[model samples]
Target chain A: MSERLLTVSSSPHARGKQTTKSIMTDVIIALLPATAVGFYVFGLKAVILVVTGIATCVLTELCCEKIMHRDVTIGDMSAALTGLLLALNVPVNCPWWVLMIGCVFAIVMVKQIFGGLGCNFANPALAARVLLVASWPSHMTGKAFIPVDAVVSATPLAIIKEGGDAIPSALQMFLGFDGVYGCIGEISAAALILGFIYLLYKKVISWRIPVTYVATVAVLSFCFGLSAYEVLIQVLAGGLMLGAIFMATDYVTSPATAKAQFIYAFGCGLMTVLIRQKGGYPEGVSFSILFMNFVTPLLDKYLRITKYGEVKK
Target chain B: MEIKKGTFKKGIHPSYNKHYTSSLPIEIMPSPKEVAIPMSMHTGAPATPVVEVGQYVHLGELIGQAAGYISANIHASVSGTVKAIEPRLMGNGSKVSCVVIENDFQDAPCENVEKYDPETVSPEDIVKIIQNAGIVGEGGATFPTSVKLSPGPDAKIDYVIINGAECEPYLTSDHALMREQAAKVAGGLHLAMKVFGLDKGYIGIEDNKPDAIEAFKALNDDSIIVYELETKYPQGSEKHLISAIAGREVPSGGLPAQAGCIVINAGTAAAIYDAVTEGKPLYERVVTVTGSGIKQPKVLLFRIGTNVNEIIEYCGGLTDDIAKVILGGPMMGPAVYDPNVPAGKGTSGILCLNRADAHIEDPSNCIRCAKCTEVCPMGLMPMYLGAFSQKRNFEKCDEYNALDCIECGCCAFTCPARRPLVAEIRVAKRGVQALRKKRG
Candidate 1:
C-alpha cells in the first residue's frame, strides 16, 4: 500500500502547469523591446551598462547568499531583472564605477540584506537609484546624455530647474530628440516607450501603476509651473515611464490590494511632482517610488481589499 | 453594453488551460475488482466501521456509520466480500481505517434495507434519508450535508446557495454534472429547500462558464436564479458566494447559517437527488481526470474506493514525464505520491502534471507587495501569516487569520518574485489549528 499525502501545503506544487521559470522567461521577453531601444539610442554604451549592471547584480546576489549560508538563487533571474532595471535608471554617461555601486546597492543592500526578492519592502533598483542619486549628485546630474549622433543636451527637467527659457520641445522630448546630453539612460523617450509597450503587451506590468502615476504627476506638475502639455511631456519623458512600468510596479514592494495600489501610484506621482517642483532634485521618479515603497505595507494594512462576503465597513 | 459587476475587489486571471478536455462528457469508470472505502473522508469526526472482516456486503451497503452529527456514513462501492477493515492510505498523506471489499463480479444482491418514500417523506424524514445516504459536500470540503442542511433552533435559512462556481481551474466535474444532471440537482435543491423551508435558491457560476449558466437558465424555475459571477479564483468559496449573491456577510468566526444561508455544491445536490429518488447511498461521484501530462482527459463517473492509478490508466495513463499527481484541481488540491488510494467522495479531479510543469524554485522573502492581501477572499494577510509561519510563531499566525485561508492559491499565482506565500501560510494554519484543538 502507498502512503497518502498533504495536498494543500501551499503553492507552488512541483507539478503545476506554470512555473517560476516560465514567468521569469516571460518577463525577460517583455524587457527585451526596451533594451533594444536603449541600444538604438545610446549605441554601445547602453549595452555595456546593461551587461555590467547584470553581472554586478548577479555576483552580489551570489556573494550575499553564500555569506548567509543560503542556497544560490541565480537561476531565478530576479537579480538579472534588477540589474537591467538599474541600468535603465542610470545615466548613459554614468561611469562604470557608478553603475557598479548601483548594482551592489540594488542587489546586496536593497535586496539581500533585507531578505531577498519578496521580502524587501521597496523596489531594489529604485532604492539603489535614490541612494546613488543622493551620494553622487554631481555624477548623477552633471553627466551629459549622448544621442546616436553624439549630440549632447540637458534634460527638459534640467533646463526647467536651471531657469532656462529654451526648454526642449514637446515633440523633441516625445521622440527623445535632445535629452541625450544630460544622462545616458534618460536619452530616448521613444526607447522607454517601446519598453512600456512591450511590458503592456506581455502583461508583465499592469496599466494601473503607470497610467495612474503618470496622470497624477502630469496634473500635479502642471499645477506647479509647466503648461498642461509641458506637464504631459514631463510625465512621458525622463524616468517616469521606466519607474512606473518597472520599478514602482515591483510586485514585492508594491501594494497588493487594488485600492492600495491606486493610492500607492498616486503617492508615487505626487512625490515625483513634489520633488520636481520644490525638492533639490530636477527629476523625481526614483525618489518618489522609494518614498511610496516605505508606505506600501501600511497602505496594504489599512487599505484592505474588500474580500468576497466581507461586510463593507 | 454594461460591464458585468464583480463580487470581490481583486483577483488574478490564470491561464484557463481547460481546452485539453473541456468539451468531453463524463465517462463511467468500471468498478474495481476490490474497493477500499476510507472512513474519514469528511472533515469532522471519522465514522467507525460497523461491518467486520470476511463479511459479505452489497453495493450501497453501509460499512461505516456516522459517529457524530457532523459526520456522514460510508458505503460499499461494489457488491463484494469484506476482505479486511484496516488502516489505508488517504489522498492527503494521512491514514484512515478503510474497509476492503473484494468484488465477486456476480454482483450478488442483498435484501432492500429501507427506502424513504420521497412523496410521503416529511422534511425531517428527508434529513434522515440524507444522513442515512451518507451524502457530504462534494466541492472538496467533505462537510456532512445533513448538518449543514439542519438549521439551528433560532437559525432560519432564506437562501439555499448552490455552488456551481467551480472556481478552481481544470475541475469540471461540477460543470459536467450541472449540464447533464440539472433535473437531479434541481430535485436535490428542492429537498434541501423544503427541509430549510426556504423559498429561493441562487446558483452561482463564474462568468467563464456561460454554457453552464445558460443550461440552468433554460430550466428557468422562479425559485432558482442563476447569477453570473466574474471569472475570479475562489469565486466559488462559501463566504465569497454568500457575499456575491445574498450581499450577506458571514461574520468572522461565524458560520454561513448565521446569516440565513446554507451553501451546497452542485455535485452534492445531484448526489442528494440520487439518494432520495433512487434509494442509493453516496458510493460514487463524477471525478474529473485531467492535466496536460495525461494522454486523454476525461470526467469519469467513478465509484468511491476505486484505485486512482487504475482510473488514470483508464484515462489513457499518465504521460511519460508525469511530475505531480494531484487529487483535485491545481489551485487547492494536495499532491499524492501514492496512486493506490481510492477516490473518496470529495475527490472531484485528478491532475497529472508533467516534469516541466512541476518544477518550483525555493521562495524568496516577502517583498511586501501585499498582493496576497488583495486577492485573499478572507481578507487575511498571507504575507504576515507566511512570515509568522516561517518564524514558527503559531499564535501570531492564528491572530493573522491563517485558518481563514481557503488555500485558493491566488496569492502564490500573482506573486511576481514567486514567493511561496500560501505554502508557508498553510503550515502555520495547520500548526495553529492543532494548537486550538489541543487547548479546547
Candidate 2:
C-alpha cells in the first residue's frame, strides 16, 4: 500500500457527467429535426450547403487554433454546431462559396480572434449572417428563396413588409409555406418547436429565454394593434422561432441569471418588434439578438441575485 | 404529533452511492496494536501534551489537556505505553504533534472515569462534562460542541437540531448509527434540549433514508420531531439544515445561534449521551470504509487514531486499480497521498476511488452557461468569481461578495466546462480577506 502511487487534490474528487463536448453533442442532436426539415423542403442544395458550412467552419477552426498556438478544440463540436446554425440561417439556394465565406467568418473572426469558444462576445452564426446580409444583399436576400416548384419568391416576412395580401396564412406559416420561401431553418415552425422540446427535455437550455422571448413578441405585437391572425403569423413567421430558441439562448452570448435572462430576452423581443415595424430591415431576429449579446455582460454584472442569508437594509 | 417534511432551495441531487454500506450493520473492529492520536483534531487551538514518552496510560485517560477556552481535551483510545511524542501525518495532509502509543491490549478503564444520573445533573454541569470528554461535532466540522452549547448571553437560541441528513454521497456512518443506536441519539437530543431549556427538539433526515427516519420515528418521543428533508446534496450543511428545519437563515458571517438554532451532528449527539451517561470520552468513532476501489465496503466502529492503511486492510484492502484515497466523502473530503495518515476526529469516511472514478478532466474555458449560478446553494455567482480570481482581480471578487461562498463544491461539480469553480472561489475568498485586512 505504501508503494502504490495515489493522486492527492482538494475536496470534490467526483465531477458531474456533463462536459462541454456532451453539451455540444446535445445541442447538435436537438437541431436534427430542423436540419431534416430544411433538407426535405429545399432538396439536395440544402444538404450541400450544410455540409460545406460544417466542413469549412471545422477546417477554419483547426487552422486558426494552429496559427494561434492554441490547443486544437474542434472535438468539442462547438464549431460544428455553429456551422450547422449558419447553414440554417441562410437560404437553401445560397451559393456554396457564399456559405463557405459565412462559415469561415463565423469560426475565425467572430469566435477564434477574440480568444476561443467561451471568450467570443457574439454568437458566431448570427454575427456571420449579419455580415453576409450586409456584404452580399442580392445573394442573401431578394429572390433568394426558392420553393419546391423552382419558383423564386418573397418570404412571408418580406410580403408582410411590402403590405402585400399574398402573405401565407397562419397555418401555412406554422407548417411551412408550400408556395413561399424563407431561410432554410425558418421554413418550418413545427420542426423548430420539436427541436426546442428536445433541448428542454435534455436540460441543454432553460425555458426562461425562449418562452419569454416568444411571449414578448406575441404580447407586444398585439399591443401594436395587429389583429390576432396577424399576431399568430408574426409569432410563427421567419426566424422568430429559430432565433428565439437557438440563437438568443446561446450560453456564451446570453445572460447568466434567470432575472437577467428575462430582461435580456425582453429587450430582444422589444427590439425585434421595433425593427420589423419601423427600422430599415424587414427581419429583426438576427440584429436584435446580436445587439443584445453586447449587453449580456452588463446585465450579468448588475442583476445578481440576492445572496443566501443576505442582510437587507 | 405529526412529522413534518421540509427542504431548502437550489441544491443539486448527485447520485448518492450509499447502497454499498447503507444496509450493512456497524461492526466493531479490534483495536490496532499502535495508535497515533493527534492533538489538533478539533477546530481551534491544538491540545497541549500532558504526558511524556514511556508514560503508561489507560483507556479513556487524558493524555492531552485543552490549551485554551476553544480547544478540546484529547484522551487515549487504548490502554498503552507512550512510544513517542512527535509530529505525524494526518488525514488532512498536515503533520501535527501526535501521542504515539503501543497498545498493551489490557482493556483497563481509567480510575477517574465517573458516571452520573441525567435526572440529577444540572444543564451547566452536563455542558462541563461534555467539554471534559472532548466531544466535537462528529459530522466532520469538529467544532468544539461546548462552545456551541454555551452561546453568548445575547444569543436567543430556540431550536436544537440534530443533522441526520448525511447528504454526502457514498458515506453511511451516520445512517448506520441512526439505525443501530436510535435510543442513545434520542437521549442525547433530550439532554441537549434540557441544556437549552427548550421544549421541542428536531431531527432533520433526508427523505432518501427512510430506514433511519423509521428508526427515529419508532421512538415516539413527543419532545423530538423528525423532519423528512428533500434528498439533496449539502442538505446536511449546517446553514442549509437550519434553513430547512428551523425555517431560519443564519446571517451572513454569523453563527447558527444568530438564527436561534444549535445544529449538532447525529454522531455528536450519541457521543454526548455516552459522555454524560457512561463517562466515555470521544476517542473512537464510526467511519464508513467504502467506494468502488475497496474490496469490501463497511461501516466500522474503530479507534480514532488508527492508520487508514490498517482500516483499509481490515476492509479487505484496496482493489488492484485504486487511484485516489479520500479521507471523507467525495465532495468535501481531502484526497491524501499517504495511506499511513491517522484518522482524526473529523474523519468520517475513507473513500477509495478506482482509476475511472478518480479521473480528472482538463478544464476548458467558461462558456458563461450559468449552471453554476443556478445550483449554488449560497446563491453567489461562481462563474464571475472564478473569472475574476483567474485574472487576479481581488477587488472584483470582493465586490461580488466572494466571501459569502460556502465552498460546497456544488458549482464545481455541476460545471459542464469542468471548471474548478470552488477552488478558484476559495482563492478569491482568501484574496478578499487579505484585501479587507489591508484596508483595516
Candidate 3:
C-alpha cells in the first residue's frame, strides 16, 4: 500500500521529453563535423591540444566545485563543451601549457568565480581566448599558422593586411586546401556548414543569429571593397563561419528573445567587420562575440515583444 | 465555405491519448454505499444545508439551497438517509462543508422531477431552471452558469462557443458526451444563446475528435456550425477558443463577454439541457477514469459525491505500478493524496498514472532556450518571470506581466531545463496581486 502512495505537486504532472543535459548533448553532436575535420586537418598536434584543453577544464571545474563546496555539475557536459570550444578557438600548434592555462582561466575565474554556467556574464571560452590574446600574444600568433606537411602559410587576413603574393581561389578557401592556415575549427567552411545544418535541424539553435550575422558581414564587407572576389574572400576568410554558427549562438551568453537575437547578431557582425578592418587583430571573431555577449542582457530588456491580445490606444 | 479551423498560435502538442476511453461508451456506475456532497461546489458562496441528519431524501431531492445569487443548489445523487452534515476532504484537496448520506440502494425518483417542453419555455425561465438545478461550468471551473448568462446589457454577444475541444491528454468525458448525446447538447447551446439574444452558435471541437465532430455535424442545425479546431493543448481554453473560432480576442484580464461571445463547455451544455428540459439536477456527470495504471481505463457516469476510492475499486482497483492519482486531466488537474477525497462538481477525470507517465525531474537551471517564451500562448516571457519569482522580486515579476499568465503550464511543460515555471509564476502572481491590494 505504501508503495502505491501517490505523489502530489502542482498541476502539470506531465512534462516534455527534454532536459538541459540532453540539450548540451545535442550541441556536442552538432559540433562533431567541425571538430572531426579540425583533428584531421591539424594532425596529432591538434588532437593533443584539444585533449589538453578538455581535460584541463574538466579537472579545473571539478576542483573548483570541491573547493567552493558546490554540487559537482560536470555531469551536465557544459564544462566539457566549454573546454572543447576553447580548444577549437586556439591554434593547432599552441603549447599544451598555454591551452591548459586558458582552460583553467575559463572554468575557474571567468566561469566558477562568477557563478557557474548561465550566471557567467560573458562566454567563458571567448573570454579565455581574449585574455590569452592580450597577455600572451606571441603564443596566439606565429607557428600556430603552419599546416601539416606544408611550409609556413600566411592566413588570408595576414596576406590581405600585409603585402603578400599568396592569394588562394575562393574554392580553395571553402574546402580549406592543403596549405591555407587558420585556427583548428575555423579552417573548413564545408565542415562548419554541415554542423550549422545539423544544429538547425536538431532545433538546438535558431538560424537568426548565424544567418543574420553572416548576412550583415557580407553586406558590410562590400562597402570596404567593390569587387565580388574581394567580398567573397572577406566572407570566406578567418573564423567567420565558425564564430557565426557556434559562438554567437551560445544560448546562455546570447539574447533569448527572438527580436533581441537579431539585434545581437547584427551587432556581432558589425563589430567583427570593424575589428578586422580597423583594429590591430588579423582575426576578430572572438573579440566580436565577446563584445556582444555583454550587450545581450541590455537587448533582452529593452527589445519587448508585443504580447498577444495586448493593444495600445 | 472554407471552414476556418480554430487554433491559437504556439501551443505544444502533447500526445492526445484518448484511445483508452474515447470509444468506450459511458457506463452508469451503481450508487456507492456512502456519499459526501460538498456544499461549496460552485465558485461563490457555499450552499447552506436544508435537510437535517436522519432525514430520508429521495434521488434528485434538493438537500442544500443556494446561499447567494452567485451560487448553485446541491441535490442528492441517491435515495438515502442523511447520516451527518460536516466538513470532508474534496478531490481538490480542500475540506468543505458536506452532507454525508447512507445510500438505501432503492433508486427512488423525486416527485417534483418531470420533463418540460423546451419550445414553450422563455429564455429567463430556462436560466432560472438551470440555476435551480445546480448547473455550473463543468469545464473544471465550476463557475455558476447563471453569472456567465448575464454578461451585462452593453455586451452584444455574437456567438455561443460550445467547447468540445477536450484537448487535455488521456481524458474523454466531453468527447463521449458529444458522441452519445449531441441533440441534448445542442438544445442546451440554443438555451444559452437565447439568454444573450444571440442567433448563431459555434461548436468548436478539435480535429482529433473526428467522431465527436461527426456527431455534431449530423445535428443539421444551420445556426450552430461544427467548427473543427487544430489539436493543441489549451485550445479548449476559453480565450484561445474564442480567438480561434470567433476571430476576436478577449482582452487581457477580461472575460469572453469582452469579445462579444459566451463560451460553455460541452459537458455544461449537456447539463444545462437536462436541467431545462428533463427537470434533472447536475447530480451525475460523466467522468473519464483513465491512465496506464488502472486495470481498466473507462468513462463512467459518476455520482458527484462518490469517493475516489470507490471509483478506483469499481474500476478494478489500482495496478502495482500506480504512482500519482490526479483529480482531473493531467495538465491542469490537482494531484490527490488521499483516495477518500470526494469528486467535486468540476471533476472531469480521475487519472491513476503509472511510474512511466508520472516520471518528473528535480528542477535544474534555466538554459535560456526561449522555448518557453516561444510556446507561450500569452506571449509573456516566462523565463524572466520565473527567475524573478524565484528570487522573490515581486516588482520585476509584475513588470514582465506576470498577471497575464493563464497558468496553463505551457512554459513549464516546454522548458528544456524542466524549471518549475508555472509554480514560481503562480507564487509571483499572488505576491504581486497582494502587493497591489495593499498599496490601494
- Identify the candidate with maximal DockQ: 2
**Compared with the true structure, what per-residue lDDT tens digits does model 2 show for residues A10-128?**
67778888899998998888888888888888899999999988899999999999999999999999999999999999987689999899999998889999999999989999999
- Per-residue lDDT for A55-115 in model 3, tens only? 8999999999999998888988988888888888888777888888899999988889988
lDDT string, candidate 1, A62-94, tens digits:
999999998788887888888887887777777
Candidate 1 residue A255 Cα shift, in angstroms, is 3.5
Better of 1 and 3 by DockQ: 3
DockQ for every prediction shown: 0.32, 0.82, 0.70
Candidate 3: docking tier: medium
Question: By TM-score, how accurate is candidate 3?
Answer: 0.97
The residue pairs that clash in candidate 2, if any, are none
Query: Which pairs of residues clash in candidate 3, taking residues 3 or more apart in a chain or in different chains?
Result: none
Q: What is the alpha-carbon interface RMSD for each candidate?
A: 4.8, 1.1, 1.6
How many angstroms is residue A300 displaced in model 3 relative to the true structure, after the best TM-score fit?
Answer: 1.5
Per-residue lDDT of candidate 3, residues B1-440 (tens digit) = 12347688877888777888888998999889999999998899999999999999998999999998889899999898999999988776778999998999896889957677877788888878888899899988899988888888788889888999988999999999999999989999988888877777788999988988888778877878888999998899888898889888888778888888899999999999888888999999989999988898889998889988889889998899888999889888989888788887898999999998998888777778788998888888999999999889999988898999988888889888788898999999999999889889
Worst 10 residues of 1 chain B by lDDT: B1-10
**Clashes within 3 Å, all models in order:** 25, 0, 0
Tens digit per residue, CA lDDT, model 2, B1-440? 34899999898888889998999999999999999999999999999999999999999899989999999999999998999999998877688999999999996899967898877878998899999999999998899999999997898879999999999999999999999999999888888998989989999999989999999888888889999999998999999999899888989998899999999999999999999999999999999999999999999999979989999999999998999999889999988888888897898999999999999898998988899999999998999999999998999999888998888899999999989888899899999999999999
